[model samples]
Structures are given as structure tokens and as C-alpha cells.
Target: MTDDADESSTSLLPEPLRTVTPLTGSHRDESMDVIGWGIFLGLVVLLLPLLPFILIVWLISKVTESLTPS
Candidate 1:
């Protein structure tokens, strides 16, 4: 009949999935955003050029393997 009863029923849920508090802006999240973007961009810069060579090598391997007798 009350919100307490509703909450008691929801206790069956996992603790992490339960809404314990309202979301708030976190400095740690903001710092992580900066670091995440840096790592993402670093990976992009490092891998973008390698992608073509990787694909070419992969294609060549597949072609050679297919051409070779089983």
C-alpha cells in the first residue's frame, strides 16, 4: 500500500541495477572523458594509416591461400 512495500519488492534486483540515488555530474567522469578521447584519437591516428596495409596483406594471404592447392 506504500512506497516502502514497493521498494521491498524491488530488493530482489541486483544492487548495481537498483536506483539508490539520482545521477549527478562527476569530476572523475569528466576526467575519464578527456583520457578516453585522447586514447581513442591516439588509436585512430596510429591505426588509420596501418589499416590499408593490413587489409592489403590480409587480401594477399587469402588470395595466395585460395590459389595454392589444398
Candidate 2:
């Protein structure tokens, strides 16, 4: 009975994880950087068409902020 209880208790505990692989490479780092920059530039490019709208909104917000009392 004691052995069964101990076995059950041990079974209830979580198992330890196996070893994990680490990343190490200049080419990988460069590719990742390129991907990151591409994503960033893509976002900027996508937002390019909305730049004027963003500027207008910003100007309106600033004007409102200036006109409103604190």
C-alpha cells in the first residue's frame, strides 16, 4: 500500500524537460535582421499612403490639445 501511494505521488509529479537546442550563426542572424527590416519597411510602406491622414489627425489632436483647458 505504501509503495503504491509513493508510486502514485511520483506519477502525479511532472517530468523534467529534455535538452533544448540553441541558436548560433552569423548567417542566421543576418537573415533574421533582413527579415525584421523587411517587415518594418513593409509596415512603413503600407502606411505611406496614410501618412497625410495621420499628419492631419496629429495636427487636429495638437490643435485640440492647445485649445482645450488643462
Candidate 3:
């Protein structure tokens, strides 16, 4: 008996997950980097200052509601 193996068999995973794409183009790399930095800076600039005020107001509301007679 002769043993034979087929090379056409594929796993259940998607092709993109199994393959690696190269990012050698400068424009693609720069665009991706800029987008990532923009998201990071946007969150820091916009949300960082408001977070503390939001927490303080939430805590004050909770305390006031608890202290007030129902």
C-alpha cells in the first residue's frame, strides 16, 4: 500500500488570519500611524479633563440622594 497526502486541505481559520501582509509602502504606514496617534491624542485632550468632573458630580449626586429623606 502506498501512502498519499493531499496539499489542498485547509483549516477552519480565515485566510487573512493565516496570511501575513507586508506594510512596505510609506503612505500606508504613515496614514496608519497618524490615525493611531490622532485617536490617542484626541482621547487625552478631550476626555482626560472631563473624567474627574464627571466622577465628582456622580459621587455628589449619589451622596445627596442617600442623605435626603425619602
Best by TM-score: 1
- Best first by TM-score, ranked: 1, 2, 3
User: Which stretches of candidate 2 lie above 4 Å from their native place?
Assistant: 1-28
* Deviation of model 3 at 53, angstroms: 1.2
Candidate 3 lDDT, tens digit per residue, 1-70? Answer: 1232233343354565544866565446788889999999999999999999999999999999999999
Q: Model 3, stretches more than 4 Å misplaced?
A: 1-37
Q: Candidate 2 on 29-68: residue-level lDDT in tens? A: 7888899999999999999999999999999999999999
Error of 3 at 66 (Å): 0.8
Please report how far candidate 1 places residue 56 from its true position, in Å: 0.9
lDDT of prediction 3: 0.80
Give per-residue lDDT, candidate 3, residue 15: 66
Residue pairs in candidate 2 whose N, alpha carbon or C atoms collide under 3 angstroms:
none
* Residue 48 of model 1, lDDT score: 99
lDDT ranking from best to worst? 2, 1, 3
Better of 1 and 3 by TM-score: 1
